[model samples]
Target: MNRDEVIAATRQWIEKAVIGLNLCPFAKSVYVKNQVRIVVSEAKHVDAFLEDLDRELEFLAAADPQDVDTTLLVHPTLFPDFLDFNEIAGIAEEAVVEHELEGILQVASFHPRFQFEDTAEDDIANFTNRSPFPTLHLLREDSIERAVAAYPEAESIYERNIETMTKLGLDGWKALGIPGMGGEKK
Candidate 1:
């Protein structure tokens, strides 16, 4: 798909995932890196964003499932180059950070191709330590609570992942290929 199409599709997928998991609007924005940085915003509109993501992932997966594994490390934060990592970090609460990190790690671990170490500390540290690269930011209001209320299962999964990551150590996290500051991929 073209860049515009890819952006649109990514938004859709994000919407579906949120609706499917019943997540709340805790924050907005996602970052990813391609040949260059691309930022996809307007994520406050959960439905629209998720729809776009769903389509994009489906297209990529259909083209080649291996692409998913290869590109997962591309860094979603590299999209929109306008935002700052510290700014995004400021907007996020400990709970939200824990939740997202856990969910992503779980997904990565379960994927057939990626070999995510079963070390939560390692994963969390690697993710949190990532360099600030502005990409897509979802503008959320009070949607996160709604999502949690609607999708209890997804919430549980997120919680489990957070707990697991918390147990891992900084050294372990460094072992993972998580990015450092300034979008430096390790």
Candidate 2:
């Protein structure tokens, strides 16, 4: 897919799964406010990808939260293997520290095949983190703090997400029409 198509698919997943399912209670607010920034990376190699990541991290750190509260750095074809994408997540964390945005910004990972530790590859719970492509979500620490403070029982989000995904099931996820989640081998 081209860059625009990648972004469109990502937006659809955010709207249908993340917001529509209420998977992330904190997502809807910034999303509806148009504070979510989505960037599609065309980097063809790991080094270039990290460069893209570094640029995004800096941009997000300097951007006004009112204008861009969070960013989704989506890469469609770079890390097709989930394990490689998972490793990139560790590198992404290091990038946050290298940029000296440790306390200011953080990175959360999402992939088409995001398997939680010890969870089977096809476990429904993994669907909670699954997205149309491998994405590194950049978030502001202060925003997370405020959201947590205002949210009651904020700790239950993971369990709630698991429950939501389980209820939705693989069939339900496919019905959402997200690319790469059709329950067929790619």
Candidate 3:
């Protein structure tokens, strides 16, 4: 897909899956305010992708949160496989620490086939992290702190999501109409 198509699809997924499902609870505000920046990476290799990631991190660091509160580096071609992306996820996190932006910036990952440890690959719960593409969600920790503080019982979000997914089941998730998310081959 071209950049525009990639961005369109990503936005649709955000609207339908993330906001529609109320996964993060904080996503809609920044997204609606246009503080969310989406960049489609054309990197074909892991090394190149890392470079792209570094550049994005720097960009986010240099940017004003009011102008760019968060960013999504969408990589549709690189690391198409979940494991490959998952394996490299560590490096991504390390970049944050390496930059000494540990408490300032954080990375939230999503992939077409996102699976968790010990869970069955087809587990419906994996949908929590699944997105239309292997994308990196770079967020400002201060924003997250504010959101969590304002949210009562924020700690229960995860458990609530698991319960929700369990109640929704795989079939229900598939029915949501968000393309490229839900069910198996995790």
Best by lDDT: 2
1 against 2, candidate with superior lDDT: 2
Tens-digit per-residue lDDT, 1-186, candidate 1: 244544544443333322222222321222221211233433444345444444433333334322232112122332333223333323333323444432221111111111124643235523322322233222222333444566546546556544544564444443442233222332
Tens digits of per-residue lDDT for model 3, 48-91: 99999899999999999899999999987777788889877879
Candidate 3's error at 41, in angstroms?
A: 0.4
Error of 2 at 23 (Å): 0.7
Candidate 1 Cα errors over 4 Å, as ranges: 1-84, 88-133, 153-157, 162-186
RMSD of each: 14.4, 0.8, 1.5
Worst 10 residues of 1 by lDDT: 105-114
Q: What is the lDDT of candidate 2?
A: 0.93
Q: TM-score of every model?
A: 0.27, 0.98, 0.94
How does each model score on lDDT?
Answer: 0.32, 0.93, 0.87
Worst 10 residues of 2 by lDDT: 177-186
Best by TM-score: 2
